[model samples]
Structure formats: structure tokens, C-alpha cells
Target: MSIADRRRAQGFTQEGFAFAVGVDRRTVGRWETGKSSPQPPQRPRVAEVLQMDLDELDALLTSTGARPKPVRSAPSAYYGSGDPDEMIRREFLRLMALSGVIAAIPDDEAEALEGSGDDFGRMNGHLWQVYQLARTKGSVYPVVQSQLTALNDALREGRAQAGTLCFAAGDLFQLAGELAFDANRYHDAAASYSLAASASKEIGAYDLWSCALIRSAYVDLSERRYRRAADTLGFARRIALRGDGSLATRHWAAAVQAEAFAWLGDFGACEEALDEAEKVASLSGQGSNGRWLRFDGSRLAEERGARYLQLNRLDLAETALKDALTLAPLAAGHSFRRRGAVLVDLAAIGAKRRDSEQVMQYGLEALRLARISGSGYVARRLRAMTVELGNLGRDRHIAELKAEIGTLAA
Candidate 1:
């Protein structure tokens, strides 16, 4: 029988059943119509209200053609035989589904397994290193997806401690959010960050929670929601204060706050925040957790440049961007997305100064990098630079540069 039939058999209307389970009547209607399944936290309450055990409820829920498909194992040759990019995308989606299944199980009922928390922790640490060192950030998505699957499975199967699971989930969610953000999926990124913050708060991981909030603020900042971003950053700063003052979390919050303030045209506040971020260098030990939290002020120069560019301080922007270019890794080993962003900012500076030659030089280089990396982040930045170029008139070189960028964008 379907869930709706079982509910009717038990003499409860949809609204009555929803009231018993403390969910909206629409939620019950959706469950009956196969529009959505009960989430993990709702499963126990749902089973109770239905007067059935978990297994019986599962069967009823699946009886209405709403069951999840059985997960398939990857073929022996899957890793090396398929088109590489397609393989990554397929595996990434599969792993994401696996995480969902794992998340759906209740902690108390999950069977205890033999995996150690340290094992998962170490593996996650290595994945973070791989991501940081990869040429294009997209290359890390598959690995992050896999790690998230494993971590979720471990948690659901009771192989990891509750606190450890929460911490790991928080970190993995942040990394997932980064992938989504770079792909220009702002809504997805915001959702992931919200999940991360929720997980971190469950474990009282102040630094992780604050970092998630700061990352969420970036989505708002990118969308030109300056006041909302500032509010988020301000809340993150307060959370960071409750943690280790010596950690980079507070400083990282300040750095992002600097950008938001610059966007608001609060030059004095921006500079003060930048100064706070710079103090991380004078402190000992870099203040990072080496895995999900690494803010040693390495990106400060580039960030300062971007902030200055936003504030229309072309002279300061040029100097900071030049220093950033020197400090950033070379083309062969560097992050294409990061380098492309700095180059785009330099092009903006050139456009502001009406230096056609400079604009072409930086703009074309950024376009080349964007094409090579296939980064939506770089493409978005290029689109913004195009708007900046509107005032540059009809110079032949500038027109040619814009045409090339348009082609790359297309």
C-alpha cells in the first residue's frame, strides 16, 4: 500500500496526520503524491504518526513509485576508460546521491562499523591539499564529492564520533560550496554554506561555523547585496571572537569585511579591516588547521587590489595587483581561476586610466586563461570588466579585445 492508503486505513486525514507529525499539511500531501520523501529528521516522527515501524514505512513510501534507485558500483575500467571529464561528472553525481542516502539514516539505528575517525580526517586533509595545488579548481570537485560520500557513510554507519562527523561535514560542505561558487551557482553555494554553518554549530566548532558564514557572505557580496554581506561578516566576526583570538578565522573575517566596506564606499573602515587582516603575519604558527581553514594572509595582496579597484583607487589597485602577480604561482603550476581574477582586475585598472594598450594586454591574457580553465568565475569577472570597458570608446584594439572576450564568453 502507498503512504496515503496506509494513512487512510489508520483513520487519519492528511491534515490530521501532518498535525500529529508536526509538519505542514502540504508536506503530507507531497509525500502522498510522491513529490518528496520525508527527510532524515522527520522520518522517526513520521513512522510514529503512521503507527508503523521504520521498515514498514519505508516499504509504503516506496510502494508509490517514489523509491530511490539502488546505487551501482563503478565498473573496474570506469576510472581510466571513459572520457575523463565525463567520468568525473558521473562519479561526482553518484557520490552526491550516496551522501543523501547516508544522511537519511538515523544516528541511533545506524550500525556500528570499523572505520576510525582519524582515517577520515587524514583523508580529508589530503583532499584539501590536492584542491589547493590543482591547476583548475574544477579538477578537485570529484575528489571532494568522493570524500563527502565516505564521510557521510561513516557517520551514518556509526564509525565516526558525532562531533567528528559534524566537523567533517562542515569542512566538506565548505569545499562543496567553493566548487559551486566557482561554477557561478550562487544559490547552490549559499545552501551549502548554510549547511556547513549548521553542522559546525552542532559541534560548537566556532571557527568552522564562522568560516561558513563568511563564505555565505561572499555570495551576497557577489550579487551586490552589500549591506547583507556586511551583516553576515559582522556576525561571523563575533563568532570568531569567541574562538581562539590567535587563529586566522578572525583575520579572515576582517579581510572579507574589508571588501564589503570598500563596496559600500567606506574607505576608512575598509583600510582598518585590511590592517586587521595583515596582523595575521606578525602572529605565530600561521593559525590555520592545515585542511579546511588556511588563511595565512597569502591572498591579502590580491584581495587588497580587488577592494581598491572597487573603490576606484586605480593607483593603489595597480600596485597591489602587481605585487600579487609576483607572489602568485607561475602559469604552469598556479590556479587559473585566481590568476585570471587578478588579471581581470588589472584590465579594469587600465580601462579606468584609459590606457588601451594596458587594457588589451591584461584583458586578452585573462581571456586566454578563462578559456584554458573553463572557469565560470573568470568568465563572470570578464563580463564585469566588459561593462567597465563601455566608456573606453571605439578604439580598434579595445574593440578587438572585447570581441575576443565575447567569443570566449559565448
Candidate 2:
């Protein structure tokens, strides 16, 4: 969407949106008409006022054939170039699915590279979406490496939009860390997450920073360091609180915290966190967008089921997992990873009860899904069921299930 289109959709008049961007209404007119582009330092505010990520803002500017050109020669002339509209600084992003959070960018860092920062942000977001959809994660490495190199060079050379570039870099770092996590490279993932958190902190991107911390918690969780994971989640929850209230930043953190708390056997804390996560359903907006915020309560049921399973509450886990299975996202097989995880959980319940038939039924289906989707997450869950499978060995099917899980690829 172009700037005008996005502005109107977000319920902003030219004068109103541009007014918040600290630019003249005439400047917006020129931008939409492809006559002029916002100067570098002003682009961030423009993007924020439009209630969009830097990538989306770039789309609007680039769509109109507008290009940013830093006005280094004159300062007074630029500020007095034209009159802007009267608009409140109340963030429009709350309307953009990110609750009442407004970013406070240094009026200066919005202008760094000509189009590189936006390009990086856009490409990084696209790569994350692609990564989420792809079964095998390794294929995205080449492109990620290339983009990382270019972005790093740009970061060093670019000066004005330091914060913008850093945010884009942070987004890219998270994606890179996700890839490392998928490959089971825990150390590398931690490093990438650290970089992500640092970069995001530079820009005061509460959501982004919190997300990095959440991912870091996953590393500790994978290592069976429950205490460390809980600590990390505790920090993430605090960071998320500083972000836009409309976004699901805090809720997502709560969800993860719920999982961590469950692992710690803190039943009260887990329930409290789960209740907080469920509140996402009451939000007026989706509480997410094309950026890093993907928690919209769509997977809340599955999340609840997983938490219950962690706490060994089989009845609750079974009910919630079954409910999750009936949901469209799982029923239609939109996400094999999620579906497979649920199946594995169900199989674990069956194993706990010494129900061979039930174990074989859900376990086999989960194994099949793992093969079809090549999801390491599902594979890991399937492999974790080995201890449960050890409790039952009278049936040949149980032995086969254990063997298959052992042979699953990393």
C-alpha cells in the first residue's frame, strides 16, 4: 500500500498523519505525487505515524517512486518549507494491531541509508514468513548470509538512520537465530539472539527486544535449564510491558512464561500466565502484523494444552489438545509443526495410561506428519516420548514407534 492508501485506511487525513510525522502536509502531497520524498531523519516518524513497520513505510514511499535524499545543506529552510496539520501524537499503531504503543525515535536516526534500511527490513520480514512456511530451514541460509553481509556493511557506513538500521538488523538477527535453533546449534542461536536484543535495545523497540529475549529463553528450555529459562522469560515479560499495549507483545511473553512456569512445576504461576495470554482474545485488533508480533491468540488452545502436558495434567492436556485439533488452523493442516506437537502430546498421554492402541494411533500419525513436514520441532517432541514409550513394551507396535523416533533426523 502507498502512503496515502495506508494513511486513509488507518483513519488518518493527509494533514493529520503528516502532522504527526513532523512533516508538512504539502510534503505528504509531494510524496504521494512522486514529486519529493521525506528526508532521511524524518522517514522513521513517517513510518510510525502511518502505523506501519519500516518495511511497509518503504513500500509506500517506493510505490510512489519517491526516494529519500538527505537535506544536509539546509536546516531552517527544511523546517519552514511548509505548514503541517494539527494532529495528536497518540499512536495510530494501536489501530494498526499494535496496542497503544508509540515508539520514541530520536528525531534524527530516521535517516541513514537511502533505501537500504527499508530494503533490509522488508527483505528480513519476507524471509521470516518464508522461513515459517518452509519445511527444511537450511535452504534459506544462502540468502540470509548475503543479506547479513550487506546489512552489516551498511550499518558501519550508514550514520543518520542508525536506529532504523539497527532495528532492521535486529529483525534479521532473530530470523538468523531461529535458523540456528532449528539446526540445533544452541550456541550460535544464543549469539544471534544476543545481537538481536542489543540491536533492538538501541532503537527502544520493546516488542522486538522482548521477542529476542523470548527466543533466548527457548535456548535455555532446550538445554533443560528450567531455572534459566524462567529467569529469561521474567526479563522478557518486563521488556514486553514497555511496548505498545495493543500489540500481543506482553501476551506472547506471558504464554512463554506459562510454559516455563509449567516446566518448573509452579502451577500457580503457570495458570496466572496462561490467563494473561488468553486475554489476547479480548483485544480489539489482531495484536500483530507483518513484523515480529505473530501472537493473535490463534494458537492459545494449543499453547494451553502444551502447558498442561508439561505440568502432567493429562486430563486438561487431552481436552485442550483435542480442542486445538478441532480448530481450523490444525484441522486444515495449515501448520504441520503445531499439529504434530499435539499428536505427540496425545501419544504421551496414552503411554502414561499404558494404552498401547491409543499410543500407536496418535504416535504413528505424529511420526507421519514429521516425515511429511520434516519439522525438527515435531521430531524433537517425538524423540522425547522415548521415556514414556519405555513404560510399555508388551506390544510390538510400541517397540517400532520407539525405533522410528530414535532414527528421526535432527
Candidate 3:
């Protein structure tokens, strides 16, 4: 059957289907026209709205000759001179609205999950929907933050059940913490993580509790508080050991330990932790849904690259970073942040060699990616690289690069 036919079979008009799937109606028109195709990440939502599995949807599209062309990475040509703060805020609200609908479970059926009641499964799915929505856009923060406050109010008013409401509240707080981390607001991130940990503990959400601790450790790492970071991650690691040995919990603990050891300049311990991390990557199977398993060792590659960068092992650093760049999925919004980081490191190596062309090339790309993602963390790191690049002296291109970096500074 054709893609349109399948949607019609599912009782959705073109506009109705587009609205249901969170996309523009014209984009849907183009899809059905076979003029273009939805991106891979978008396909799952399309299937969900059509009430078909992904494979079946793909088959229908294929049968209708709806082929997707490759989308090449283009340099930022339209970095608008608009207020980024406003843009970020708008995007955040859009994501929150999306999350609200996606995260809602029917009130009647919501009570069945505890003690193998259906409520547990339903709530788990809803929590995961919120998590996935947050992962897609930085703009979801305000909505999540509002939800966190609302959940607390509900608890205070004694208007909600303890089990499901508490779990949902913890999940919302965790997403807020994640958004704070993304914005490079470490103090806010730390506070949100602390609240998430408390809520998770209250709800017996061991996985989420350990994850929150790992997040808190990242804040400590940002402040160069290595010893404190280690303490936080060590506590998480211990808790993870007693909590089902879930792949996500174990991998997160090992990844943070690797990062902590790297900061301490303990290469031996870092490598050992990395080895444990690799074991998690070697799991027999990963569920197809990426909602819960986003931490599958990609950052470990970045950590290795950063460690080598710190040790002045430029050759190893370059190799590791290139490996990280290869493993990072370009369409993943956060991958730009990672690639920008590695590029900055590589640019540093170019500076050491007096290779102005290489430095400009990599540094410019990093700057562009940082601004596009509004990644304050990457933007800060790139600003530091600008200072080192300055000693190169007397090039208009270098001057322009510095200008760009200045705009991104916090």
C-alpha cells in the first residue's frame, strides 16, 4: 500500500496526520508527493500516528517509491541576528507542549502499574515520552520546569496518588536537570539534579537516582572539582551495583569514573574504567527504543579524546577524537556539541604546528556548531581556544574567528 493509502486506512486526513505527528502540513504534503522524505528519527513518529510499526511504514513508503536523499552538512549560512534567548525560549515551549500530550496516560487506567498492575507500565512509558522529548530540543526546559512545580503543588494539595505522581515528578525534575546541564548553567544543573535525586529516592527509582548522581558529578567536573566529582560518582557506582546491574546505570557510573580519573591524571585508572565501559557496550542486545538507552558509551570516546588532549598526547588525542567524530550521529542535536569539542582540540594541535589553515578550518567549524546548538559549554571551550589562536597573530580570518567566538561567550 502507498503511504497515503495507509494513512487513510488509519482514518487520518493529510493535515490531521501531520498535526498528530508534530510536523508541518506542507512537509506531509511533500512526503506523500514523494518530493522528499522524512528523516530517520522522524519516521518512528510517523508510524506511531499511522498506527503502524516502523517496518511496515517503511515498506509502504518503499513500495510507493518514496526515497530519501542524503542530507549533507552545510555551513551555517543563515545564523540570524535575532535574539538567541528568545529563540531558545520559543523552542522550549513548543517542546513542552509536545511533551504534555505525549506524557499523559488515561486517568482511568493509570492506577494499575504498582504490584505488576498496568499502571507501572503505563507510567513508565509516559515518563519515557517526556525524556525523549527533552532529548530532542533545548526549548523543552520551561515546560518541564513548570511541570516540576505543578507536580509539587499537587503533592502539597494531596490531590494525587503517592506512587505515580511522585514518579512523574521525579522524572520531570530529571529532565529539568538535564536541560540545565545542556545550557551550561552548572549551579542550576546541580540544584535540579539534587532535587531529582531526592524525588527518585522517595519513589524507589534506583536507575534514575543513580543517573541523577552521575549528572551532579558532571557539575563538579565543570568546576574542576575532581575529588568531589569522584566522590559523587563513586556513590553512584556503589548504588548502581546493588540496583539490577542495568546496562545504563553501570555504563554511566563507569563513564563518570573514567572522566574523574582523567581529571586526576591517573591514566591507569582511567583506562580500567574505560574497559568496564566497553563491557557495557558489548551487551547482547539493546532495546530498539532509544528513550532509555541514550548513554551507550559514545561519551566514552569523547572522554578518551579529552584525556589525551589534557596529557598533551596530541597524536593519541587526534586519533581518539576522530574516532569520536565518526561514532557521533550527525542528526543527533547534541552530536554537534561533541564534534565541536573535538574540533577545538584538533585545532589546538594545529596551533602547536603553526598550521594556520588547519586551525582556522577546525576552529571556525567548532564556533559555528557551538552557536547553532546554543551549547554554552562548547561555546566556553571554544572561547578558550580563541585565546591560544590569537598568539598566531595578523590574519583577517583569525580575526573573524575571534569575532565569532566572542559572540558565543557566556
Candidate 4:
């Protein structure tokens, strides 16, 4: 028997079993998932909670359990028993799901995944960290989709912690939207963000809702509908205001709003929004969860530089971009994406000044980082940079840069 089967046989929910054993619920989940085992000190408690001798517990922990059949096979005589037509209908639907004609997870399997809010929180946070650090973002997609499916099951069942689970759903939706946005699938990203916003609103998670709306606005921003994005962001600002003041949600929203303002050539409005974003520095530890909201003020300089670059203020952009490169995180090589972005912006400044040498200097550095990280984000930015390099007019080195970037992005 696996730890999961033993725990369930003891008539304990995963969360309840963890409480009795005096460990975090996710620890039980890890144990059951065969990812980890209880330490020597904790084994006694775990054995006691499962009502088993220590030796039996050890054997259970080391053994695998039978996988449940997704569609149960009825007994030979069941066709003659109660409500045969209803049974037939249920079996047919299960068959369809099993055949991949429709999406569904077996009820038993889905039920086994239910846990407390902290479980989802810890899982989502860990997955976010993995996604952010992963060399290829697509590698994280399968697990996110699997988790989301299980989460939908939990929601459908309306479990005891429905509201908290809904918050997790909203956060996961935002993550899905991020993956889509990073791939430049604006339509899909917008749909995910909209669902995220709805989920957040259903649970009164103001900050999450505001962040979802801000992300949704990015589709508009990417489409070059500056006024529309700005308007959407204005509403997001109000939504953020209703959230916890200590969170950096409002500040992050303001920073993105600055971008729309910059693109629209409203210097005063852009400056005011930037000023609002600066307030994030006043909050302790940048008031970020490092998962759902990773503002942390680390990229504020880069953001300012990018906004200025958009407005073609090359000198101002150059100054901020250089400052961004000097930030502790970037200098220590902690953030590949941000550093690449700032470098690209610097290269664009060089292009605007018609200095091929300067352009090559920054562009080559950015290209090297992209190659190392294999990040879709860096490749996407490079795709845009190719346009500016084209305007630099027929230099051999420039052509090499363009070819390398195209191949990398492809």
C-alpha cells in the first residue's frame, strides 16, 4: 500500500492526517505522492495517526498501490439491477472521457487530490518559482494544466475551503495567462486573464482581481491601443485601491499604466504613474509574495527605461538603462529576462543614434544571455529589436545579429 491508500483507509482527509501527525499538509501530500518520506522522528506520529505499527507503516511507505480504474467495470449481473439506463448513461460518459473524446478526470482520482488552502498556496508558489527560473517556459506547461484540471474538480465539488481554493484558481489562471502572453498569444492571454479576474472577484480578492485586469490590459497595450489600455488600467488602479494597502499590487498596476501613458505621449501622466510605482520601495521587502505579485521594485529602473525608449527619449532612456544594469540583482546575474530587456533597450538607443559599434556592443551581450537562458521572453523582445537593427542600414555585423536573433526566436 502507498501512504495515500493507508491514509485514506484510516478515514482521514490529507489535511486532517497532516494535522494529527503534526506536519504541514503539503508534507503529507509529498509523502503520498512518493516524492518524500517522513523523517525518523516523525515516523512514530505518522504510524500512530494511521493506526499502524511502525513496521507496517515502513512497509506501506515503501510499497506501491494499485492504480484505480478510471471507468469501473460493472459486474456481469448488474444489467438486471436497479436503474440500468442511468448506469448505462454514466458508463457511456466515462467511456467517452476515457477514449479522449471529452475532458474528464475519474472522480476517485480527483477526490484524492483535495487539500487545504495552504496546500494550493504552497504548490502554486513553488510552481511559479519553477516557471520563472525554468530555461524553457513551455516545459512548465504540462504540470500547470494538470494542476488546473484537478483544481477545477475541487471547485466543482464545492469543498469546505471553496473560497480559498477559488483564490488559488485565480492565481493559477493568471499564471496561465502569463504563459500565453509570453508566447504572444494575445487572444488566449486575454481570455485567461478575464477568467482570472472573474475568479478573484468571486472570492473578493481585490489585489488578485486588480492584477488580472492589469494583465488583461496588456493585450490591448500589445495591440497598440494605448488609450484603451490606459482606460482599462485606470479601472485596475481603483480595484487595487480597495486591496490591502501593504501589497505592491497598486504600485505594479501604476507602473504598467505608465507604459500606456508613455506610448500615448502624455509625459505628465506617465511621470505621475511612475511616481506612484516608486512608492513600492517604501513598503518593507517590497511587499511582494514572490509568486502572484513579484513587483519587488527590482525592475522599476528597467521599466522607466523601457517607457522612455518607447517615447524615443534616447538620452533619458540610456541613462536609466545603464542604471538598471547596475542594480544589485542584474549585476549579480540573478534575472536573465530583465537584464536582457535593459540591454536590448540600450542597443535600441545605439541604433537611434546611428552608432553601429554601440549597437553591436549591447546587442551581442543581450544575444548571449538569450542563448544561455533560452527564454521566450528574451527571444520575443529580440524579434522586436530586429526591426530597429534593420533601420541601422546594412552593416555586416548588424546582419549577423539579425540572423542569430531570428534563428534563436524561431
Which one is best on lDDT? 1
State TM-scores per candidate. 0.70, 0.71, 0.64, 0.70
Q: Between which residue pairs do clashes occur in model 2?
A: 40-111, 99-246, 99-247, 100-246, 101-244, 111-161, 112-161
Global lDDT of each candidate: 0.74, 0.71, 0.63, 0.72
User: Model 3: per-residue lDDT, tens digit, 199-268?
Assistant: 5565565666777788889888876889899888888878767554545676777777787888798888
Model 3: CA > 4 A from native? 1-137, 287-293, 329-334, 390-396
State which candidate, 2 or 3, has the greater TM-score. Answer: 2
**Ranking of predictions according to lDDT:** 1, 4, 2, 3
| Candidate 4 Cα lDDT to native | 0.72
Clashes of each: 0, 7, 8, 0
- Give the per-residue Cα lDDT of candidate 4 at 180: 60
User: In model 2, where is the ten-residue run with the lowest total lDDT?
Assistant: 80-89
* Candidate 2 local lDDT, 1-410, one digit each (tens): 67678789889898766544545678779988889887644554465456555456666677778875533323122111111100100111112122211244642342232124467777887887888777766567657756766665565555325556667767877887776676554655777788778767766777888999999999888778888888888898898787767888888888988988998999999999999999998888788865566888888888899889888899999999899888845557458878888899999999998998889999999999888876667777787786787778667889878767755554
TM-score preference between candidates 1 and 4, better one: 1
How many backbone collisions does model 4 have?
0
TM-score quality measure for candidate 2:
0.71
> After aligning candidate 2 to the native by TM-score, how far in Å is the CA of 13 from where it should be?
71
> Per-residue lDDT tens digits of candidate 1, residues 1-410?
88988899889999767755656778789888988887643554467567775556667778886663322233221111113323433443444444443332333322121122467667777888887776566678777767766765665566756656666677777887887677655655776788788776755677888999999998998779998998899899999887666689989999999999999999999999999999899778768876667888988999999999999988999999999999886654557887999999999988888888789989999999998877767877887688778778989888877666655421
